[model samples]
Target: MTGKEEPKEVRKYLQQSHDRIFENNKKWAEEMQKKNPAFFKDLSAGQSPEYLWIGCSDSRIPAEAITGLDPGEMFIHRNIANLVCNVDLNVMAVVNYAVRHLKVKHIVVCGHYGCGGVKAAMTPKDMGLLNPWLRNIRDVYRLHQAELDKITDEAKKYDRLVELNVYEQCRNIIKTAAVQQCWAENEYPVVHGWVFGFADGLLKDLKFDHEGQLKEIQKIYDLTKDA
Candidate 1:
């Protein structure tokens, strides 16, 4: 192969990853057997993850690793731009299960400042296959276009857009029928907006609380309302 040619060992790399995971799991099982046998056996039965994390599909930001949580701690749903759409069945199913069955107390929408997906959404170019996914981010821009357009600093504008996108996605999650139903019946679960900073590997909460700011949205599913 030429010096500039891309590596053609994608399958080999995948095999290597499988090997590593096997070794890791073996070591983990051995440690668990030695130290915490009962806990391991209980975990084997099933998972009871408490947090539902909706995050970008960036390789850098791993939900489990960032939070330093174990395997069955956080249920995750990842997309290109980390968008929460009402019509997305896959995400909806995860949310339904997490809230209804698992009873997850927190639903976190995590976005990163250096997100390629958000950057693509800010541009006018055709993203081809990613158009539909990024369209949601574009909508966030449209909703706050006046503010975004007035910001002369390009870097600052991009950062603000990323934060805004997270807040909007958090709002979108609360607007879901299942989440609203959860709110109607109980107050256990709460939606939160967070941003992961790639530079420092720190998570900053955007303070977008679904319960406090979006009470009017909950009225849509109020069962007590006269029909």
Candidate 2:
């Protein structure tokens, strides 16, 4: 087909998809209101979430659905491979806001097995814009190279990398000043690492030691001087 003709067809399909989303949203809103008359009112008033969820931006893994959380129950931040880096303004701002303002009691860094970002990072090639972002996962592999090298099965190796990525990201969050100061002052927002598996739809907690990891990280990245 000609370029103009193709765009017309694509636009029609996208319009249909967009309309379907709003239709479903309207129905969902009606359902919520029916369940609780004050649902929308309470939601509009404000959100004081108890948990901050950091997870991969995979469409298959809906953090709220997997964790059985309501909309206002968890503040969420998602990125490719679920990475947490000091240089990333977006995630950094999210962490700071959640810890400082929201006072979230728990912060979960969740990654999933069979993640496209992790798989792409594993492949040694130039992925253009993705190279820099995926490099974080490569760093995770490098950190656990000896342990990862022991696994002969490629699938197992990939799975291990995903879990390790979550763990490292949790450590990264711990290294943040907002988290450190908040923990020192309130002893909350404990960081947790979790991995979601496609098969059987279960989350595998890596049993992150919040206080222990905080102490380990504070040896270098301590910022709780006032607290």
Candidate 3:
């Protein structure tokens, strides 16, 4: 298809999808208002989401839809590969608000097995627009280069890298000042690492528990200060 015709074709499909979503939203809201008027009424006044989901911007894996969660249940932040870069002001602000104010109990760093962003970071190409954003994953690869190089199966190696990226991002969240402060004050908020498999539409836990991991991070920070 020609470039000019592509826009018309895309718009045709998008318009259909948009209209359906609009109808669904209206119906869902009306149903909720009827079934549980008090819940929706309080939600209208303010939101107090209990969980924060950091996920990839991949359209196929929406946090709410995948988890069957209602609005005001989970605060979310999505980027190219659900990265957790310490320097990203946008992600930092979301973390700050979710942990400090919303008082979210669980923070999930979710990556997917066949993540395009992770695949890009595995390559050596200069991604002009996404270079800075993907650098965090690249660093993860660098840190685990020795183990990654030892894996013989190419596909298995890539999968390992994807899991490692999720683990590292989960660790990164624990290092953040807001999360640390939350830990210091209350033990309610726990960070978790997850990987969504596109084939089965299932989320697999990477077994990164926040409580034990935070202690290790604190030790590292303390040792650095001592040095």
User: Whole-model lDDT for model 3 versus the true structure?
Assistant: 0.88
Q: Give the lowest summed-lDDT range of ten residues in model 2.
A: 1-10
User: Sorted on lDDT, highest at the top, how do the candidates line up?
Assistant: 2, 3, 1
* Number of colliding residue pairs in model 3: 0
Write model 1 residue lDDT over 83-184, tens digit each, in one string. 888789988898889998999999999999989999998889998998988899899999999999999999999999999999888877887666777766
Off by over 4 Å in 2: 1-8
Each candidate's lDDT (Cα)? 0.86, 0.91, 0.88
Query: Candidate 3: where are CA atoms >4 Å away?
Result: 1-18, 37-39, 222-227
The alpha-carbon deviation from the true structure for residue 36 of candidate 1, after best TM-score superposition, in angstroms, is 2.3
Score residue 86 of candidate 3 by CA lDDT: 76
lDDT of 2 by residue, 117-136 (tens): 99999998999998889998
Clashing pairs in 3: none
Candidate scoring better on lDDT of 2 and 3? 2
**Candidate 2 lDDT (Cα, 0 to 1):** 0.91
Please, what are the lDDT tens digits per residue for candidate 3 over residues 45-120?
9998989999999999989999999888999999999988878899999998999899999999999988999999
Please report the candidate that would top lDDT against the real structure: 2
The TM-score values for the models, in the order shown, are 0.87, 0.94, 0.87
Per-candidate clashes come to 0, 0, 0
